[model samples]
Target: MTQHRIRNKNLGLAELIAIALGGMVGGGIFTILGISVSMIGSLTPIAIVIGGLIAALAAYSYVKLGLYYRDEGATYSFFKKIYPNSHFSASAIGWFIIFGYISTLALYAYTFSSYAISSTDFANNIWIRKGIAIAVIGVFTLINIWSVNGMGKIEDLMVYTKLVVLTIISVVLMQHGTSSFGTFIDNMALDAEKSNIFSVLIVASLTFVAYEGFQLIINAVNEMTNPEKNIPRAIYSAISLAILIYVVISLGALFAIPTEEIIKNKEYALASGAGNVLGKLGTNLVILGAILATSSAISGTIFGASRQMSVIASDGYFPHWLAIRKNNSPQNAIVGMAVMASVLILIGGLELILEFGSITFLLVSLLMAVANFKIRDKTASSTFLTALSIVCLGIGAILILYYEFTTKWEQMMAIIILYLILAVGAWVYSKKNEMKGKSS
Candidate 1:
């Protein structure tokens, strides 16, 4: 009935950081590696760092509004309370954010499948990967529908374990990397000469998906103490750690594996290439790390996003059936969310899903910046930082749109049509709520 999980201030700063880091450092790095390398080559690290900065800027508004609102519903809840009279605006935000989660869900599962398929005999079988991705989504959907409270604890372990595994993978690859540090820099220098700033910026914009899960910290407001102190600390610390982790892993890969190999492998780049360079032991380590990273990412996304979906439904912005619950779980929303994600994996390729998710979150976070600006006084937000968030996030969205328009117009159009569909759905629900409000 409540917008958030039961209130319990048991999570400390360390736990808070883990939760935010867990939400973030998930499938993002795994999904973006090959694409970023392909687009920017040895300059991927620079683009990744820029992307991290962009995430930091977005976090400013979230932290400000989060502390002011102190509501666990987060993005949706913020908009709803802030624009209490604008049913359409609130409804649209809820719809956008929920679907945004769905896009990321598909990204994670697809990435998982890519890595899962890499070690198999049918590595090139697209249909088999799709099948595995859908099946994994189905499994998680059942666990959610069945209401497995214990999964949360397991998710925490996956988070910590994956971090260690990734670190080990990074170190191993760096140790056994075929290329020298000097060669790596020379390659980067060569890349810089060949590529323009726009290329790196575009890649940076695309990599924003890797930095998204930081907002999960606010969702735990009810479970953390000293909101004023812990919120910013946890979010900022987690983002910094994520940036470090990503930079290290990416640089290690660039040094250890060739650019063509990474680009060629695409989805399963790390695992596939690590075998040739780091041998069987190293390759297996990367696969295990990728699996844990993506698996937890998928589970966490479904759980958090489904809860938000249920809340949106309860508020009448989504299908009423999605509000149905069993054993305190949003069974209908869970199933509906799973079905949509599986459909996405079916139709869209990995890059399409990745770009769509990055764009959606960028747009949503930009909206949050605008909302924060409107209530700067109440939230005590810095006008300069808020404007920076708006400007930077707006540009990031534009850059992604620009890339898609020029190189992948078909995907661009698909994204636009999807938005059109979501907008109409959000509007219809908001309209229904208005009519019901007047009749009562």
Candidate 2:
């Protein structure tokens, strides 16, 4: 089949905002909050705020790169333009990001299925749940493939809806929450004394998952309107709003639910907390909100991952066929990402997917931070921010890697294996293409 070229266009502020918000608000907020509270007790809000700061630092690095590079491949292009020796490393890092995003899609798909079942009785049937999850992925893939613009609009709406839902829940819970100042102080006291510093670090790393969406804006920098300015604006705005929402929700849950219940039953703490404050309907509303949150995340993730493949293929790292666009969308990349994500859903399930994806994403953030440094040597501006970025990312990466090895060795290994395979695949493909060009 003849290959078609995929073109890039400038995306506007609104589009960038939609992509960032959509990417960031997924399954992590709805699900990870409960698990995080279990690990750090009432200090969960503090942990989330810390994670947000690290994420903001990383986002600043991207903004610096985005302003200088303004290329289609985002981090890949940034590293390639600034540190030619590390092109392969940058590409591999980008591949890890691709895998990370796909794994995120898998997690959201699973979460969507679980929430669907819990919200409605029909999801109890195993086959039904699997079918529904797969179908959701399929529908989202189709939407993205049909039109990137359409998907952008959908994501914009989803972001708004999720923010509103979470805000309402947080406000209600905060108003009705009954924890005494003494109880709050006591909970913090116990956490500080009983919990290991390392354990809090590990739990805090999970909160970083909530910050994942902001990077999605970078993937489509070429399509963004005035990316030089809007990219940073979108990143800062989305992350700031997300952090505020997370803190309120976390604090609300802490105050509304007993510490013992939250620690023991991490999976449904939010629902239980809502039930305590707002009754059955309140709990149901949170579930419905989760559905929106997960589904939006899943959809936005599919869009971002597919576009990454398209960008890579356009750069000649993959077969040109993968870059072919139909109706302003990368059809093959969309399908390929969907299939890979679906297989991961089947193999690792949701929990492993989240852990694996988080590890890969943390590593990529580190690479991007380094890329910022590499670029600063080439350009004179933004040196201070770039240096700050490197330090913050280095500290976060160390914490995340330490936690992964200690608490999640198996999933960390799985991420390593997958990354190696992608690296080798990219290398082999480049060599074969070089040979073909020589022969011709």
Candidate 3:
């Protein structure tokens, strides 16, 4: 006789939102504020809004595919299923998307260390920051390896608490303003007049990395209830909330803090701005918000990305060792990802890491858009939006590359070298898997 099995369905819409929000709202806003402000001044909010729109565009395809396939493996799984005949496609995407997640892991950890030490006596110590970043990655890796349920509950607490604290900080910053609202508006207008449309668009494109985590909801499809309804609701709701929160925070910073200060202290811009304008209490609030924000992000990234890695590994696209699990968790993959992120922190510069992450995700999301368009009928995705998404994402990818090539050619070369390395690695793995299959 055959036996049937039952699975737990405890997660609801709220927790799903928390997962998506926890992934998207981490160190992104904190890290991008200074870079955006430096490029576009007070018009940063406009660029942020555009970035959010791009994220929404990317989310549409993700949501459609998530519902159609309902796979926990997400990007890698989606592509593999769509192109099952191509080992190259599977291995390449597995490498690209996993590395993309690794970049984000580094991004969040670096931002966490920056804020964690921003108020300390050693705020400017580079080595200390990197050390702390690695330490936090270790902490979260253990948390993720320990228990999925524990990670989810902790993610909920951290994400929702950070949101409330961040909103309060924005309100307080607006109320205790140092700059006049009129001046802020005038500055935005002046910046808009001075900056080119292309620059604004490029910055918006780069900022797309900030919205990279919304697809994480799809990764938890097995744990969540009514995934068909909840996936769309959670993802869209999280992106909407993230856009509103980012806009309000950007506006508050522009009104209450000097643009120069924000650009100057880019690493800890929010806390720095709050410290200057709103005093110690304000600074403390910002610090707490940031710490919570990055904490949830690290935990969530490990939780989601490790699962994807394990899936890829099980298919022989990654090392077989990474497929090992304990208590139904991908503990080895989680630890491996954390270790790689730590290495990235030690060797990588902030701007290089940020740009690489943005470009990688933009490219990955663009691929996703293309994949969705190819199967729009089956996924029930609108062909028009999918086509539009491909165009926008493609343009964004080109603009980012153009901006990097024109200005930061060295970093572009490094990125190319990294891609080549990943390609070779993926090619080797794909060949190995093919050979093994033939032997079998």
Candidate 4:
């Protein structure tokens, strides 16, 4: 007889939920607040709720597949194992997902930089901001590479603290609100009449990106306990809490701040809005929340994505050196991702990176839903819900593409070119593996 032990499984349900929340709560809400308000007006909260529902749909399949497979490689691992013979499928997903993580890594860091310096005199200095972004990414990378338990504890602290700060900020904003609840509802009704259903759905689709980080929970499967029970609980609970937080925050902003100001100071709308209503104290709280949100996001993104990248590399889908791990941590992969994200920060254009990240993740989530539907029976997923997830994600993907094409064709083209480059890289590596396997 052989004895087996699961060593160092330190993540409980709270930490698991924290990981999912930390991943989902980052720069997403801060970045999207202004954009969603600008597009949907008082209907911003409605769209956010819709977006969360869409996220739940996407999360359904992930929970099922994650529990079924329990692979730390997450999205890439699930696909690779499900379609073992199709190297291109594995390679393409690997490329899309890794780059998707890179884009988000850049997004969260860039958002962190924005809120970090918003109160300083050097706020408008692009160079200074980029430097801060790079520095933060470096700090989180070291934290991740140092110890998994350290990273988890830090993540739990950051996520919970940010939630507390955010709640305080939301309560303060509402207390000082200039507009009444009745007026807000009336305003929403007025805006709803002028807003098209398609446009609202598009905004919701764009918001799919904000819900991006919950899958980080799946990436930590190796360190977690009771995958069958915890995976679904953590993901679903996190998504539900995210929806509540986003809606409340949106309501707070809408009731207290004017639409024009939100549109004008889109980058730091909450901070600016708080400054007007609650003065410097209010502004400072909002800024604190944003910093904590983006910080945890950066740390969570690096922690989960690097592990997946190392797994992909070990399987020959990425550079071999990226596969190197020390003390159960992929140090090299974490540093590599941070370097690339830092470069993106220097490149600027936060909105571009945000949209690209959103689209990439949306597409990847859609694929996961499809994969789950294929194995619905094995995963014990609801057939109808799995099919619905597929349809909803598919719709969201198309809406984003349509919105990009109509509003920003040049940016859309750049995203397309980026995808093509990734596809080519995938083809090359996948072909190399195929040839090597045949030769053997």
Better of 2 and 4 by TM-score: 4
Model 2: how far is 174 from its true place, Å? 2.0
In model 4, the worst 10-residue window by lDDT is 1-10
Candidate achieving the largest lDDT: 4
Best by TM-score: 4
Error of 1 at 154 (Å): 1.4
lDDT of 3 by residue, 1-440 (tens): 01110254556788778878888888878668888898899888889999999999999999999999988899999999998999998999999889888988898888889889987898899999999999999998888776666777888899999999989888778878787778887887899899989989988987888888898888877777888799999999999999999988888788778888888877477777677777898899998999998998888888888889988999999999999976566789999999899999999676676676778889989999999998999998888999999999999999889988998899899888888899999999999999999999
Top-down lDDT ranking: 4, 3, 1, 2
Instruction: Note the Cα lDDT for every prediction shown.
Output: 0.82, 0.75, 0.86, 0.87
TM-score of model number 2:
0.90
Off by over 4 Å in 1: 1-15, 122-128, 142-149, 223-226, 324-331, 346-351
lDDT of 1 by residue, 81-112 (tens): 88899999998888888888888888788878
Off by over 4 Å in 4: 1-5
Per-residue lDDT over 98-195 for candidate 4, one digit per residue giving the tens place of the 0 to 100 score: 98889888888877888898888999998888899999999999898777778889988989998988887777778788888889889999999989
Query: How many clashing pairs per prediction, in order?
Result: 0, 7, 0, 0
Q: Scored by Cα lDDT, where does model 3 land?
A: 0.86
